[model samples]
Target: MIRWNVVLAGGIGSRFWPLSTPARPKQLLPLVTDAPMLRDTLDRLRPSAPPERTLVLTNAELRDAILALEPTLPPENVVAEPRPAGTCAALAWAASLIARRDGPEAVMVCTHADWAIGDVPQFRDTLDRAAETAATTHALVTVGIVPSRPDTGFGYIQPGTAIESAPGAAGEVRRVARFVEKPDQARATQMVADGFLWNSGIFAWRVGDLLEEIAALTPEVQPALVAAGTNLERFFADVQSIAIDVGVLERSARVLVLAGQFGWDDVGTWAALHRVRQHDGQDNAMSGPTYALAASGNVVHAEGTQVVLYGVNDLVVVAREGLVMVTTREHAANLKTLLDAMPAEVREP
Candidate 1:
């Protein structure tokens, strides 16, 4: 089966505000490395799926910018979503396009545009395994990251009965018992102890399988998909805005979970930088001209300016274009609430 890489890159990341604007969202910004997170994601999948086969589904306004960032990708492959319909609509559209182009047997490895993957080789291996599993078993496969900590920010997946490995398969695959939403601290701790994996949002399935599941289980998306045909704009207009996890995967009986252990992080907030980016001797993740003196456990990103932290810890300081923001690591996670309280000019700029 032909393998396709489908990247869902359509969100304005409000969590990393001040630095991440609508025009230049977190996926386009250099959060992890010198290159943008989207670039890193595309590069990571390049070996398995070439540029021609890789599809990026992003907002209509960001389509031109996405093409500019990854010039190697075919212009037609950079799909422009007319509106902010959720992942269910996005993937349904992508799967329809792929099915029309390459037939339904083609496998699509779906992932978000922004993530921090530490071990590239292992990540590729796991994705390859997932694609193979999807192809062989014809089941919707999601790669669940082995939790390094009790992170209350991400959803948890409980693995059920182990599916006996196919001959020569390298990893274990299990039926999904249940999916738990972001729980409280105590619940997260207990779930982690019980070997529940983080719902990494990494999925693989044949275009046929995904479409079948959508038609069978997702009434919110199925009718729109059937009526829209190849009309992208109509599909978005007609579909209900529901996440794929809720609309399809969680409800599908054919869902399978595979454990991934390659140091995966969603990079959801500014504080996540400390875990993904390289840290200094003082244990601070510094970018641009940043210096942490007598301080530790801080994340500082400076643009066209110098930032120095003294006698402070667990702070997130971001400076760019004459605007400076300082907040505790704890508060940095809820930048949307902060943005709501800020003035229009300051928030937009």
Candidate 2:
């Protein structure tokens, strides 16, 4: 078993706006299941690690909210970041904590909270292999999801030459050639044809090795890490915003990629419900009482309310207390822009 620390959870997720606010972010919303998304994320790893070993790094404002949702998790394990300094600082802070408490050789796995996994056994098997690979190779191991379709929203990982003598069970290790960000539709199709895997944002690494990579490659947060133990607020104020993918993963030479066959979905936008949830014969995904007439490929979420749609196709309708959002499925990806265009008084809670 490997020690796990989940990063990349502190997101407002404007893509799921109106329903997802700063106080209750996407991770806290019951998007995929009845329980909060974070709870599902934690449950996915329960077989490998216990609640005490799990660490959740969230914004200071949402600490109480996270704690309420997950009462079993230790209070101290729910680390509240002083500010939003991006994934680099978050990972560094988590690594610093783990290294100080545990040892340098202690392997840690990192993942996000707002994700849906269809197969738990496949996911655990992949993580077990990833942990063994990280411990044996002393390198950063990332789970590159086996692409089920041509997805342009996620990054792609190109596997390099295989590590023949790498320790671990069979089919556990492969060298990473490079990391590529989201490409255009045409390019994304070609990437799938070229055997590129979706960058699942799941990572495994040793505490000492990750610290070394952060110190060397990410200067924006290096000083923050050095000053982390003393004052978290001061450290956060001094660091620049940068994601771990740009700061370390892209620059690190010792990165390894393992093909993950488990079904995974980031559940990024309202349109993504078509992939995450079960659709009816009319191609509509309805959570509550929703009657669709001549409508196909629509996502309707009505919380204790009756919704009636007629002659609407490819639309997202979400009805909740003090909020009613109706937008085309194509426009779901641009919800942030829509929120920005609204008045402040209407936008502010």
Candidate 3:
């Protein structure tokens, strides 16, 4: 079956402030490995879908940078959104393009460009299985990550009855019962105990299936999609900004969930480095020349300077471009608030 990779790589990623700026966002930074996160994502997807079939949806300002980073990708394939129209509009436009070029039966494997995924083979296997399920069942398939923790940061998916897999299918597929928003700690714990999967945002569907679903269930984007035809700017301008989950998947009946356990982490905040990156014996995830003395459970990223942390626990220390930011892991998640309180020059830099 023909498969296309659609990567959503927008946003300046304010959570990673002091390091992530408008000119160089989180996806372009080498947060996880030596390479940029977007580069890593593209490399991982290259084995399944070639660079020609890969489409990256990013901000208009980031288009040139993305193109420069991913030189192998066709210039046309790097879609630049005129405005922030959210994932529904982005995916709809991508599906329209795929349908016009590769026909309706082609499956689109969707993922974000700023995630950290372990077990590359298993991740590809899961995507293949989701693609197969989407093709055979004509269902919008979402890969729900098996919860490694009761993470209150992520949304949860409730799987309904099991669906019979097609011949030579990879794994189990189930109908989605409901979508739950981010819950409180107690609720998250209860949901995890009750068999809820973290909404990993990995999705697959035939171009036609997605288009049909958009037309049927998504009023927020459908009219603009139909009126714009091939004009991406017009579509973005007219379409209401809404996430794909809220606009289509949560409301659609043809949604299927495939449980995936390939060590997926969104790497959403500075604290996330502790989970994705390798740690020293003291459980400190460090990059560049960093030393942790009498410290444990800390995340430190240093660039062009040495960072030394002492007598700290669960703290985040980042040094870049002559700027140093030190905060507890708990406070790292709310860097946007700190950025808002700071001067524009300091915040942007």
TM-score per prediction, in order, is 0.98, 0.96, 0.98
lDDT, candidate 2, 1-349, per-residue tens: 3476565578788888778889888899888877889889888888888888889989998899988888888998888888888888888888887888787888889989989999989998888878888888888999999899998899999988888667664545789998889999999999999989999989999988999999889988897678756567777888889998898999999899989987899899999988888888898988878898898999988887789999889999998867688999898988888888998876765
Please give the range of 10 consecutive residues that has the lowest summed lDDT in model 3. Answer: 163-172
- The alpha-carbon deviation from the true structure for residue 187 of candidate 3, after best TM-score superposition, in angstroms, is 0.8
| lDDT string, candidate 3, 1-349, tens digits | 9999999999999899888988899999999999999999999999999889999999999999999998999999999999998899999999999999999999999999999999999999999988998999999999999999999999999988888764234437888999999999999999999999999999999999999999999999999999999998888889999999999999899999999999899999999999999989999999999887899999999999999888989989999866999999999999888987999887765
The ten-residue window of minimal lDDT in model 1 covers 163-172
TM-score, predicted candidate 2 vs. hidden true structure: 0.96
Once superposed on the true structure, which residue ranges of model 3 sit more than 4 Å away at CA?
167-171
RMSD of each: 1.1, 1.6, 1.2
By summed lDDT, which 10 consecutive residues of candidate 2 come out lowest? Answer: 164-173
Report how far off residue 41 is in candidate 1 (Å).
Answer: 0.6
Candidate 3 clashing pairs, residues 3+ apart or interchain:
none
Superposition TM-score, candidate 3 onto the true structure: 0.98
The residue-by-residue lDDT of candidate 1 on 1-349, one tens digit each, is 7999999999899999889888999999999999999999999999998999999999998999999999999999999988998999899999999999999999999999899999999999999989999999999999999999999999999999888864124448999999999999999999999999999999999999999999999999999999988888898889999999999988999999999999899999999999999999999999999877899999999999999899999999999987999999999999889998999998875
